[model samples]
Target: MLISDGLGESVVERQHAVGNEVDASVQGIVVQTGSITGDVHFRGGTAGEAAPRQLPSATPHFVNRLVEQDALTTLLSGPRAEGAVLMSTIDGTAGVGKSTLAVNWAHRVRERFPDGELYVNLRGFDPVAEPMTPNEALGFFLAALGVAADRIPAGDDARAAMFRTLVHDKRMLVLLDNARDAAQIRPLLPAARDALVLVASRNRLDELVVREAANRMSLDVLDDAESRELLAHYLGEDALAGDPEAVGELIRHCAGLPLALGVVAVRAVEFDCPLSELVEELSGERERLDALDSAGETGVRAVFSWSYRSLSAEAARLFRLMGLPTGADIGADALAALADRTKRDLRRPLAELLRANLVEQHERGRYRFHDLLRAYAAECAATDERESDRQDTVRRLLDFYLRTSARADYARAGGDSRGFVVDLPDSSIEGLVFGTDAEALAWWDAERHNMRAATLQARSFGLNEYVWQLPRSLMFFFHLRGYADDWIEAYTCAIESARFLGNDYATAYLLFEMSVAHYDRGDVDSSESYAAQSLPYFEAAGDTHGKTEALIGVGVMRVERGDLEDAVKPLETAVSIGQERRDLYTQGASLNGLGLLKAKLGLFGAAHAHFEQALRAYREVGENVGEGFVLHHIADTHRTSGNLEASIEAYRRAAELRLEIDHRPGAAASLRNLGNARHESGDLTGAREALQAALGLYEEIDPDTAAAVLDEIEVLPTS
Candidate 1:
């Protein structure tokens, strides 16, 4: 250990003005003043005449030939020269020499800090390895700082605090190289005012600016002169002088990008080609891009590829698997769903990707890939995909979403059952939420496209069950997004899938949806036909829910056709089944339909009560649109029974909530009802205005409703 002795005029100033002079020749770990110097030597049985394995030679003059980032260099070097705590950032794009600059700067300033300089390759961009954890890097740092393994703190934060405490009041240099982000670098920062931190990352360390002053340097491609000097220095002073124009072209083609320069230089050496010849070959864009990987490292792809090749089997598989997804980025929880694994199982692979620098962890548990890098991973997956493997992988991904989404839907629907008894991947669903209404809605919104693709793809694979279940799972999004075509297509596909799967019960269930689509399209006969087709299947399958849906569809069709008497039986049966099943969304739809039928049949009291129950149930199940629709129907019942004031209040409530939920058709209906109530209450002018507005929207999506509303408007008394 090293401690500094104060030497100043004032007592406090003198105590703080400390310095250390480490003795180079210490037998064991020794502390003198503020410096620790120790000799590290070991002898083993095989040490006799044996040599250490040689590392490949690093590029010569790699640091010097490059132009320095003055702002970053001055910030990092100046503060530490006089003993001050500083954090400096060197950030740049791929192949920008961020790491080289940081490392070279550390070495340059090492002599000033006699308390030992430490470096950790955080591996921010390694392709397959995970970023080194704080504890792992800190352990290595502590050992370098003469702390034994047993004495190291067990926890990461503890270790970081201890490391910082140990280095406090000492003039030391700390270099955290290739860090992913400030969050990853913050813990490792030394506590002492005398210490300096040089952090290199592709990401700008904006976090440093929040609490402490930080100097940031962003690097771009080297200038033309700098590029030429580096090339001449590497290849010989006269190597490119004869063909200055060609040399300049080569540098320009390399985009003055340092990584490209190194790659081209290495290739020039390997092939013994003159700079002109290399330039000629590189004039083709393809050859120039390939040359970037000349040394199996340093170039963007080569550096990335080297990291990728070093992954474990699981991590490698994951890296390739992410390529299969159509989306650019995936939340970690959704990724775990895609992998058919738990988040815990996913950690190693995610870490490996982070370490290798292939996958970028953008936020607190979120990850993404660079666009070009994603293209590369996609290429890898395409080449790697066997027919069977591709099918199985897709099936697994679809099944995971279907099952998880089903759990979320059930939770949102207020079903108190133990989250869909399915074979879930092992892990607590901590990050993957499902219990709350908001959580379910959020999940559905985020995964809507994936769900659609998966549903369509699953159908192609003969996954009939998935086709039906997937549509069912996505009901919330389909309804919310107002994706009418998708709703029709998904349900149509589900109907075919149900038939193919030999599940007559599911076929009947989907026929109910076909009827709803037909009704939406104003094809009353088609709606009736599909609804009638479900009855026999429901009887055979003994599915109460399917029976109720079919009955509601038939009742609605009859009501539309003015066969109110015929609609009564099916409407009552549907209401009974919905109540018995306790399926609130289905129950609400049934009750709303039955309530409208009763109001038409001159049973206003029954209709009003039914509509109230429907509204309650719809709200309970997080179906606000349905709740609003029922509120409009409740107003209709009130208006029919001559409770004009009650009808106006109910209509107003429906209109407000309907608009909030983006229920355009429902809002139009509610507005029309409000207009009718207003007319009955002698507000003829307001009635004409409301009815005209409702008719316009109804004409757009439902012309039949518009015509009927128009007839009602014609009969309204003049103001």
Candidate 2:
């Protein structure tokens, strides 16, 4: 080690000097003596990875919280205890500004830790989406720590272990915001003794306090002075000084809650009359200001009502109808459909709502209400809107979903020659038009929850046509996406809707659809029962197309039951109808059933001939889904005949085709079969690879099947 000659001559002065230069060159480690003046960095093996700065921007115009802020900073600002992590929870009621205070303090002290800050809104109290699960939160944290998603292990325990290892000894801050409970936080606590974890939640998280020894802080609303300061920040000191009496009344009604005060401030600015007038109107509700602020019944409602009454008729109606859908957020176009207007026409109204702050723009072209605001808006809608008018609004909303989903389904399936289209005769509002399959799928992905809510809401309103038609629109999407539970629930409601309407044809179609869903999911007995129930209704309605579908469904059931001869009549009749009507869709179905029946009867030659015919029919009609199914059957036949190489090729083709169309369940089945074929050919590496991919697709869509695939992989030969 060398010390610079420029050092001060006096030893006492040099000892306390800043920026002293030292250089050391050694093959081995160099030992340094005495304290360093500035940052000390050891340059040897590697530089540290980039730290993630994930904290949300601190709230603006944050008035004053010297006491709570001091408490949080004091509790977590110090270095962690030896061999232990520092953890604290800021617990408070909703809208009490828990997140506001936590984020503000985090930003202030972030420079204390050179390592980056990490934050996630656990969404424990989110009104729109489910609270983030422990695994989801862990996945987020690991990804932030620079772990690639594919490299992250399955199961919470594995991910937690990896998270601890990555964060070990790092000086970091982890803010788990809005956590649901202690269980959601424990696994996320870093193993690093140098790290600080600050959590904010509406929940008290009593377990973390008692069991884990986490420091707890219960936040209160702002006191009178702080509340006045907050109002001054928003309205300025001039506005507060202009009318001290009215200002006092405004602050009192707000109950010192930051959110309430913010809304009141906005209303105060927007008010045309004097602030005294606004105060006078709200002063009547002062008697209900009991303990706990009673935000639901008293103060907050007064604030929301002021905002609500201020809206123009158009924006007011939009806000009221928004309370109808259970979805977290809605697109601008969907809102237009609710009001029988175009998206363009609603732009002004949406702008008005934004100005009033009744609806916050969620993302581009989408808007959402804060949960409390949503509840109040809903109450207003119930009180103001008539019964008939409300029902009509639901009809229009459902129609919008039905038409949009149908269009998306058509785009997704490449081309559906099935002649199914939603024709809304009443309203001018239109669903979306897609330029590509990706666009349609993206819409569905974004609007899936809204669509689900629309279906159920239609049922509640007794709009039977929409109840059935809306689900039917999503049938293809539900099938391909392996959303079996959503598919079943959708059809079950549709079936009941059809029954209520006494529509035999509709009932038959629904019943057959249900049977197909059941058959695809491997419930053979239920499939047969639903198929049997549909036959009489189809016959009663004199519907040949519906009858043919029912016959094909029954034929598949009989084939699965190992009664090939009994299946022959219905399959042949279905073929006859297809030939007479030139319905390629029916031809594809009947030919596929015959192929399955022949294969089951050990007639390989006949099965191949039927399979070839089915493939051609499906291809002619642009039915990629049916084509994939026939190819899968052909692969099954080839494997049964001991043609391992041919079976592998065919299964590979089927899986590719199914996956291309987003048919995850079908793809998983084909992949599982492909793995079995590869294993039989003594290609263990290929076998395991195929099985693992299959397992991943199945886990979300079919966990039981995933477990079965896992069993197969476990028993495979390592070599």
List the candidate 2 regions with Cα displacement exceeding 4 Å: 1-56, 63-94, 99-219, 235-247, 267-278, 284-298, 308-324, 380-389, 410-425, 557-583, 682-719
lDDT of candidates 1 onward, in order: 0.68, 0.79
Compose the digit string of candidate 2's lDDT tens values, residues 650-679.
999999998887777788899999998999
Measured by lDDT, the strongest candidate is 2
For model 1, the stretches where C-alpha displacement exceeds 4 angstroms are 1-315, 327-329, 340-379, 382-392, 416-431, 517-526, 565-569, 572-594, 601-627, 640-643, 655-719
TM-score of 1: 0.49
* Predictions: Cα RMSD each: 21.2, 9.7
Task: Please list all clashing residue pairs in model 2, or write none if there are none.
Answer: none
Candidate 2 global lDDT: 0.79
Residues 1-719, candidate 1: write the lDDT tens digits: 24223322211222245644544433433334333259745443322222211111244556363346455446644644233368777787756677767666566566677666777767676443346557567766765665533334334555675676557787777878778877787778786777777877878888885655767778765777788877876687777877888888777766666766765776677557677776655553332124234333223443234344567888878887886655424677778766778889998888877876678886566677754466556556666767677666666677667777877755553453211222333333333446565566666655655576677667667777788888876554554434455567778888888788788766776776677666655679999999999889888888666777788889888998999989989988877877777778678888899888878889887888888888888777777766877887788778778899998899988888866755566778788888888887888998898899787656444445667999999998764
**Clashes in candidate 2: how many?**
0
Question: How many clashes (backbone N, Cα, C below 3 Å) per candidate?
Answer: 14, 0
How far residue 335's Cα lies from its native spot in candidate 2, in Å, is 2.3
